[model samples]
Target: MDCGKRHGTKYFTVSSAENFKECMETCAAIVPCHSVDYQARTKKCYLGSHHNNPLIIASSFDSAHSVGCAGACGGGGCCKDARKDDVQEPAPLPDTSCGNAGFEFAFFPNDITYLGPNDGNFNPVVMKRTQPYYKGTTTRIGVTDAHIIYGQTPQNWEFVAVNHRGYLYAHQDGEYSFTAPIADNLSLLWLGPNAYSGYTRANANLEAAYTPVDSAPLEYKATLVKGKYYPIRFSWDNSGGAGYYELKIKAPDGTTIVDGTTTVSPYLVKFGCREAYGARQYAPWGEEN
Candidate 1:
C-alpha cells in the first residue's frame, strides 16, 4: 500500500506498536525484504531490499559447478545427480573378418634393426684386416636344387656354387627362392660371385647360384614406452626351410636402423624407439600392398 509521501495529509494507522511490528515482521520475513525503516520526518515505515536469492542455491549442486570448483568446497548431490543425467557409454566395435581387424602386426617406425654377416651392419667389422666392410645394401642371393637337407639343425645349410677338379660344383640346395625388393630413392648394390668363380672356363654366364628376388612386406609388433617411442621386435613364422632364411624392414619415417638384412630365420628385428599413432594397419596374407 502506498501512503502518498508527497502529501503531508497522507497517513497510515495501525492498532498498536506490536501490531505494526507484526506487519513489518511479516513483510521483513519475505526473502528480498531486508528490514523495516521508520521515516523520521513522515513517520512512515519503508521496507528495504535484501541479499537472499534461491536460484543461486539451486545451482550449487550442478556438475559444472563441482568441476569448476574442484577442491574449493565439497559440493552436494547436485553434481552427482547432474552427472547421472549426462553420463554416456562407449559404442560397440565393428565386425571384422581378418584376425585382429586384418592386422597381423604393427610395424612402428623405429622398431627395426637389420644385422648381417661379413658385410656387417650397425658397426664396422675387420674381416681379415685386408677385407674390411661396414654395411651392405638390401640385396638378395639364392640357388635352386643344390641338394640341401631341410630340417631343424644347429646350422642350416645355404647353397653356393664352387669350382671342383675341372667342372662347376654346387652346395646346399633345394628349390630355393629369395625375394629382396629395392626401396625407392635408396641405393642398393647386388653382389654376386661372377659365374666364372664357379667354373674354370668363363662363358658369358651372367648369373650366380645366389641371385636376388623381391622382398616380402615386413611385419612387426610394437608398444609405445616413455619417450614417445616404441620398443619392438619382428614376428613371423618359418615352418619349412631348406637351409637359412632372412628378413628385411624399412621405417616410413626416414630413420633407417637396418643397414643390410638379417640371415636368421624367424628373425627378431628388435629395436629401441618410435613415434605414436592413433590407429595402425598391419600386413595380412591377402592384403593390398
Candidate 2:
C-alpha cells in the first residue's frame, strides 16, 4: 500500500514527535495503528485505526499535516468497513505497448561523492576516478518509464545517484536526438560503431552550478543503425530536495523512441562497493562496461 499525506478518519493521539519518520515508526510498532498524521509545525502525531475514515474532514490546508498509511493494508481489508460509502475507484493504467523497450537501472545510495563540492569539476576523468560506496540495484519496476522516483531521507544528507544502461534501437540509420531534464548533476555517454570523442561527441555533462529552471534539455545527436543495440549510459545525481529525473529521445524517423511515458524493464544485479583505480567498476553492472 502507498502512504500519502491526506485527511482521514480521526483517531486517538498515540504520541507527539517532531520528526515524521519517528511518528511513522511509532505507528508501525503499534498493532492496531493503521495510519498516522504528522504535523510538521507543532510536531504532533495522530494515530488512526481505520485507513479511510470519512468522518475526519480537512481542518486546514497546510503542509504541516502529513498523513501516511502503512503498506500492511495491501489486502484491501485494513479499512474496508470505512470505505463503503461513495468511494471512487482509481483509473486503470494505460496500455504501454506503443513503443515498449527495456532498460536497466541501478541505484547507489550516498555513494556518488563526485557530486560534492570537493570534486569541483565533472568530466570523464573525474567520473572514472570516483568510486561508489554502497552499490545496489533498484528493485523498483518501470524505472525507465516516465515517472518520478520519490526521494528518500538520507542518512548523513539528502542525495541519490542512479546509473542507467540500455541498448537503444534505431529503426533507420540517421541522426537521433537524446534529451533529459536538467538535474543537480547529469551525465550521458553513448558508445557505438561511429565513434565520436572529445567534448564534441554525442554526450553531455551538466554540473551542479546549473539550475534546472534556468537550464535547457541536454541534447545529443548520433547516427545509429537499424535494429542495432548500442551501448548507452546515463548517470544522475540529486544532492538534495526533490529526487526526480526524466529522459526522452527523438529518433531520426521523427518518432519518439523513448518518450517521457516509456516504461522499461529494470533489474538489481548486486550490492557492494568497488575500488576506484583497481578496475573499471561501472555501478551495479560491475566491469561489464
Candidate 3:
C-alpha cells in the first residue's frame, strides 16, 4: 500500500505480499493500521487510515478486492490512511488490561483431531473441511479464532475440531510457562505472532495428545514483556463422548495466572466487534499501544 499521500516518505510497503492481511500485519508493526485495501488477483495490499471507502480520493477497483478493518474498521469501515499531513497525532491505542474477556471459540465438524502439515495423518482431503468456505471471515484457515470471525459454534460438542484464539496479557516481564494438562484426543498451543498468522498443529509450541505419547505437554518457558500482550492460539479436538480443552499458564511469580481448573483467568481476553458494545474498549494490540 502507498503510504496513501502525505506522510512525506513511504512508511511501509511489502514487495511480495501473500495477501492483504499480510499488509495489515506489516502496517500494525510500525503503526496502528486501522484500515486496509487488498486486491487478490495482483496480490496488492493497500494500508490506510481513511474511513477508507467513503473518504479516500481514488484507487483502482477489482472484483477480488477486499476492503475492511481488522478490529474497529470491519463491516465496510475505511481502509485508507486517515492521517492529516499537518496534525501529526498519534494512532489510537488498545486496552491496557481486563477491558475484554473470554477467548473466541470455533469448532469444525467431521474433524475431531488436529494433524500438522508434517504429520502422517495430514492430507489434502482432511484439510479441505478446515478451509472455512462457509465464511465471510475465515476461508483458508484450519479451525481458527474469534466469535463473528467464524460465526456460531455447532450445538453438538462431541467429535469436533476446536480452535481458540485470543490474547494473553503478560502481567510481568519474565519467563512464563504454558501447558495443557487436560486435553482430550489432541491439542496444540501457539504464542506470539504465529498464533495470529500462519498457525498449525505441527508448529505448536506445546502439543498434548492422549495417543501420541511423543507430543510434549509443557513448553518449559517463554519470555514475555511487562504489561505486554501476545497473541495466543489454543486448538484441540475431541474424538467422541466427552472431551475438554484446558489451557494453563504460569506467571513469573509461580502463580497460575491462567488456571485451567477455573476455566478463564482475567488474563485471557478477546478483542474486536465485541469490544465496541462493551463498557470499555480494550486495546487489541500489544501494551506498547
Per-model TM against the reference: 0.17, 0.42, 0.48
* Preferred candidate (lDDT higher): 1 or 2: 2
Question: Largest TM-score belongs to which candidate?
Answer: 3
Model 2 is weakest, by summed lDDT over 10 consecutive residues, at 270-279
Task: Provide the global lDDT of candidate 3 against the true structure.
Answer: 0.49
**What overall lDDT goes with each candidate model?**
0.22, 0.44, 0.49
Query: What is the C-alpha lDDT profile of model 2 across 89-136, one tens digit per residue?
Result: 321221123322344554555444444542333333233334444343
> lDDT per residue, candidate 3, 1-289, as tens digits?
2322222112245344565446555556645444454554566655545433222222331111122333433443333333233222221222534445666554466443445432235221242235332212121122222222234554455556556667776767789988776555566777877676656555678776653323455554799765455787776666555555556688888888664444436666665322321222322322112
Ranking by TM-score: 3, 2, 1
Model 3 Cα displacement at 262 (Å)? Answer: 2.5
Query: Which candidate has the highest lDDT of all?
Result: 3
Candidate 2: where is the Cα deviation over 4 Å? Answer: 1-101, 111-157, 193-215, 264-284
Q: Which of the two candidates, 2 or 3, achieves a greater lDDT against the reference?
A: 3
